[model samples]
Target: MMRVVPLQSSGVRGHDNANVDFVRESFDSEAFGIEIGRIRAAYATSAAGYRLLFKSVLQRARAEHFQQVLRRTRLENLEEVWALEATGFEMMDVVVTFARSVAPAAALPVWPDLRVEEATDETFEVIAHERAAAFFVGIMEDRPAGYVTCVLHDHTGEGEIELVGTLPEFRGRRVATRIIERALPWFAERCRVVTVRTQATNIAAANLYERVGFTLRCTEATFRANVATALRAQP
Candidate 1:
């Protein structure tokens, strides 16, 4: 089983008040009959702190025969001293925020064969498969078409769009948009803001949010390193 260690503060925040965490953990190494460990820094961790953390992880990896050690960092936070070239890169994710006050009047789409409804336990199970603060499902001719799950933060008056998806056959029909439109009023009543995150590379998803009046807030990057190689080169 893959195991994750709790994030540890690195006490380094770059110019933007960004901080980083040192993450070290193990996974089902023995299941595969090989020890696999991972070490990474998160957020705005300082370069010095990352090196220190990496050295300690390297020592542990050697003694434990760890077959692999993975490290991840944000592109912005990455420093020259880490000395680990990125093998691959994934586009940063973009965060978008919407406000209830500016939300347009709920003009639900009228589909001749499709209808929007609150998700029942059975429908919710088929869609989200987990308990959600609130959920909405779209049904087309008695068949499940799409769904969206929402979680509300009462204190912050923020509502999160945890998941939204549509069956492949229902794509390009605005099934997702309608489901989200239907849920907005519900969210607006109780939450001041609604937020969602999507990969920056997902232009379709970004366009969808823009059509719904969500404003782009920020983006975050992801970086990776092979600690096993770094340690082997150590003299």
Candidate 2:
């Protein structure tokens, strides 16, 4: 199953009003199914307008049998958040982005006998599935302790820390921090800024980023719904 969610329009404008639309597409080759949905966020001041928007979106989702529909609103968009929640698409996640300058780092305190290295082709196959532009691995006693993937945006001169993971056994040893700290200078050399996004629900990850100099930039409320559940709830 593959799902694609793309923004159709940043926001649509009318005489004195604006709205945002996102289109989500999902395909399951095995099931031979394709689902498409449109999620709209309207800038409206009245409750009736919000209700009408939700009703239309829900009706369209049901008609198309979309397995999942998502509507994301800025944290400050309380009205949209309330309207989306009222429609049964509960807030599932809070996505937060953090940014920091690319500066040379003071040497990270070495974990005893631990070293970080560029991921080899063999390790990349197992760890990153070859999706990373660059991959680094932290090795402890010749075992993979943690890894981070860097994706560069040449046009923007920005690099994103795409994925970070530490082996369960190495969780409390600051392996994630080591991998990130190790990767930053590499990115700094190639890009002007480095950014990462993670779920706000991940307190540990958020704390780690903060301790590493990343500051909270913004957060969005993510909503999710299942078609089956929506159907079950309707008359």
Candidate 3:
């Protein structure tokens, strides 16, 4: 069993804060220890997003070999680190979803490189099952040019425009907008608020979201490390 550490709460000004918990566990793999902090948003929304603040402990314990196998174990689920204070808060932002019934007058440029079309049976079915999703394909000059998918969260009424990659030749045209237009109604029918989460560092995506009336909600720093590395450093 791992240990749970409770930290003092600083009571951030915005949104309701919750008690935070830290998870400490030992594994049979090369990694000896795994420590991660888990924070739960205080809102009552059905969709929940968890921020993993730290993941270096497994690396410290030299458990790299076992990390993969241990991830599915029950110990990882029950052992969590939680801190109620803002210091422990890693991310903040409420996803936005809009009604499809209302069309945003934003002009949609014709995708220059590709013709617009519906997704195939396989792709459509897969995207429909996602948490936040939109899926569409682009055809250019009688050929399948590109495809994209957006994610939607039913619990939070939020939508995310993900994997909007286009064929290098098909990028200049508005293939992305065409897909977004087709997906808007689908999201509106089922969700109240639709939002697109993209890397703020990507100017093109950020522009697309703003053009479609998506407002910026918030931002958070992310960290990642291998368990094997952490284990070697541990004394």
Candidate 4:
């Protein structure tokens, strides 16, 4: 399975008939602050598979302006790890996803210094469109302190806290926590499970999510390659 979620249809499924594949991640680019690509092995192969695929990756990156290419694989997949590194990819980080059912209380909290606002203006429109997601924003001191986006995959009834962040100065104020809390009732009503992911090295982040009732579900290693420099090196 492709570790990176299918953000868009990108790249040839099998280039040069190698046992590997790639897709450009349009959504992750916004999340990571860099243009990104995701690669995966269709089946186990030697380093040469990744080597041959790198050429296609470069072509796609060149055409689409990708800054980095990433591959997510299990930590135990030594063969894939070796192939990726041999192809110039470097270990980036370990990503861990946490999951839990966020049961809602009779009444969601009424924040004194915050408000839960819809992600879009569709809520106020004359006719509402079917929504697959919602953005819960946190208003602090009359400003946008932070926000958490929860996506409901109706097909599977799985909810994901797609993204969460708070201003640097708001770090210790429970901004992220309250932002997430504000989304729980919205999620609990529509999803069987709510999940969030973060760097395994970010103990503080992990602790925060756990406090919000999320528990570790899975972990994967992220590898990256800076193809822009390689592109500059090319003729």
Off by over 4 Å in 1: 1-45, 50-113, 126-131, 153-157, 224-235
Please rank every candidate by lDDT, starting with the best. Answer: 4, 2, 1, 3
Q: Compared with the true structure, what per-residue lDDT tens digits does model 1 show for residues 1-235?
A: 1111232223333343444333333223544566655444433245554444455555555666665555543344446234334222223233333333435355655667678887656655544434356788899868989988877654356777777888999988888888888878777766667887776777777777777777776554433334466565554
The alpha-carbon deviation from the true structure for residue 14 of candidate 2, after best TM-score superposition, in angstroms, is 8.9
Where does the lowest 10-residue lDDT sum fall in candidate 4? 123-132
For model 2, residues 27-90, the per-residue Cα lDDT tens digits are 2212335464546456666544554566556666677566667776787877777766666677
* Models sorted by TM-score, best on top: 4, 2, 1, 3
Q: Which lDDT tens digits does candidate 3 get at residues 63-101?
A: 423332111111112222121111122223222322223
Q: Candidate 4 at residue 208, lDDT?
A: 93
- Residue-level lDDT of model 4, residues 83-148, one tens digit each, is 667666789899999999877679887877677666565542211122236776687888778877
- Go through the candidates in order and give the clash count of each: 1, 0, 40, 0
Superposed on all Cα atoms, the candidates' RMSDs to the truth, in angstroms, are 7.4, 5.7, 12.2, 6.3
lDDT on C-alpha atoms for all candidate structures: 0.58, 0.69, 0.42, 0.71
Weakest 10 consecutive residues of candidate 3 by summed lDDT: 69-78
Off by over 4 Å in 3: 1-115, 123-134, 228-235
lDDT of 1 at 58: 56
Report the C-alpha displacement of residue 180, candidate 1, in angstroms.
0.7
List where candidate 2 sits over 4 angstroms from the true fold. Answer: 1-17, 21-65, 103-112, 120-131, 152-158, 228-235
